[model samples]
Target: MHGEPAVLSVTRYHPENPIKMFLLQPLYAPLLFPNTTSDARDHCANERTFLSWLRLAIYMAIVAVAILVNFHLKNQPTPLERRLSHPMGIIFWVLSLACLVTGLAIYMRTVTKYAKRRALVQTGMKTQAVFLVVSAAIIAACALFLAAEVQASRQGHAGAFDVTFVL
Candidate 1:
C-alpha cells in the first residue's frame, strides 16, 4: 500500500477507470456529497457568503445604471458649460465603471475564498481590512458623485430639484 499510487476505487461507479475517480472524485465530492453534517453546514454558509457578495455586485451595477441614466449632458449653450458637462459625464461614467468592476472583483474573490475554504475545511473568518478598504472606496465615490452634482448645479446646468410637469 505504501508504494501504490494514490487512487480512489469506486466499484459501483467507475471500477474500470481509476483515473476518473482520482481526478473527479475529490473535486466534486465535498460539493456534491459532504462527509459530515458540519461539512454540509459549512458549505451552506459559504454559499450564503457568496450570495451576499453577488447581491453587493448587483447593487453596484444598479448604481452604475442610475449614474449613467441620471447624469447626462443636457442643453448647454456656453462653451464652458459644454466642456464641464462632457468632463463631468466622463468622470461619472468612470466612477460608475470603477464601482461595477470593484464589486465584481470582490464577488469573484469571495467565490475563490469559498471554494478554497470548502476544499481545505478552513474556519478562519474574513478579515476586517477588506471591509474597511471597500467602505473607504465607496465613501470616496459617493463624495465625488456629490461634488460633481454640486458643480453641475453651480454651472447652471439644471436646478438640483428641477422638475417639469407635462400634462
Candidate 2:
C-alpha cells in the first residue's frame, strides 16, 4: 500500500431508502452548505439560536397548559387559587406566544441583516445577549408566580402570594 502512491477513491454516498433520507435530510443539511465565510457561520449560528428559542417557547406553552389542566383536575380550587392560576396560566401562555412571534421576527430580521452584510459579529453577540436577558426575566417571573402558588397551596391560603404585584 505504501509503494502504490496510496490512491484513495472518494464517492458521494446516497441512501437507498428515499424515505429515510428525506426524514434525516435536515440533520445532514448543514453539511451541504459550506461555511466558506465568517458570515455564513454566523448566519448558521443565528438560525440555530432561532430554533432554540422556538423550542423554548413551545416548552413554555406546554408548561402553561399543564398548569391549567392540573388545577382543573383538582376536586376544588379556591377562589383565590382559581384567580391566581387562571391569570398566571394566561400570562405564561401569552409569554410563550410572544416568544414564538419574537423568535420568527428576530430570525427573519437577523437573516436579512446578515444577508446585507451591514453588521459585524459583535452586533450578533449583543443581540443574543439581549434575547437571553429577556428570556431569563420572563422565566424568573414565571418561577415567582409558580412559587407563590405553591406557598399558597401549602399554607392552605389561596391569597398567601399576591401575583398582581409580580404582574
Candidate 3:
C-alpha cells in the first residue's frame, strides 16, 4: 500500500446513497486529487470544446423547434403546401437529433482520450472537423428542403389566390 494511491470508499460512509456516490464520484475526483497545472489546463480546454459542440447542438435543436412551431402555427392553404410541410419538418427534426448525438459522441471521445492521457490535438481536430462537415451538410440539406417547401407554398398560393393585373 506504500506506492498505491488511496481510494475513497463512498459506500462505507454513505451506505444509503449509493446512487449519489456513483454519479458524483467522477465529478469530484479531480478536486480531491489535484493534477499538474498542464493537466488541469488540458481538461479545461477539453471542457470548452465540449461546450462549443453542445452549443451547436442546441442551436440546431432550436432551429428544429422553430420549424415545428412554424408548421404548427401556419395554416396550409393548399394541398402542395400541406404535403411539403410534413417532410420538411421531419428532415429538420432528424437533422437536429443527428447534431445532438454527434456532439455527445465527440465529447465522450475527447473525454476518454483525456482520461487515457493521450495526445488530443491532432486526433481531436480531425474528428471534430469531420463531424462539423457532416453537420453542415445535413444543415444544408435541411435548408434546401425548406427552400423547396417555401417555393411550393408560394406557387400554390399564387395559383390559388393571386390576383393578376391584366391590361
Task: Compare the candidates by lDDT and give the number of the best one.
Answer: 2
Clashes of each: 0, 0, 0
Per-model TM-score, in order, reads 0.43, 0.52, 0.53
lDDT of 1 by residue, 1-167 (tens): 45744343232333223233335544544223323446556556656665665565566555545444454454323343344444544554454454445444443443343333334433233434444555665676566555554565565645554432212
TM-score of 2: 0.52
- Model 3, 1-167: lDDT tens per residue? 45645454422423233234334544544223236448667767766776776776676666666555544334443354355555655765665666666555655555454444453654456556656765675677566655555665568688454332212
Per-model C-alpha lDDT, please?
0.46, 0.57, 0.54
Order candidates by lDDT, high to low.
2, 3, 1
Clashing pairs in 2: none
Per-residue lDDT, model 3, residue 63, is 62
Candidate rank order under TM-score: 3, 2, 1
- Quote the positional error of residue 57 for candidate 3 in Å: 1.4
Task: Kindly report which residue stretches of model 2 are placed more than 4 angstroms away from their true locations once superposed.
Answer: 1-36, 71-79, 121-167
Angstrom error of the Cα, residue 66, model 2: value is: 1.6
- Locate the minimum summed-lDDT window of 10 residues in model 1: 9-18
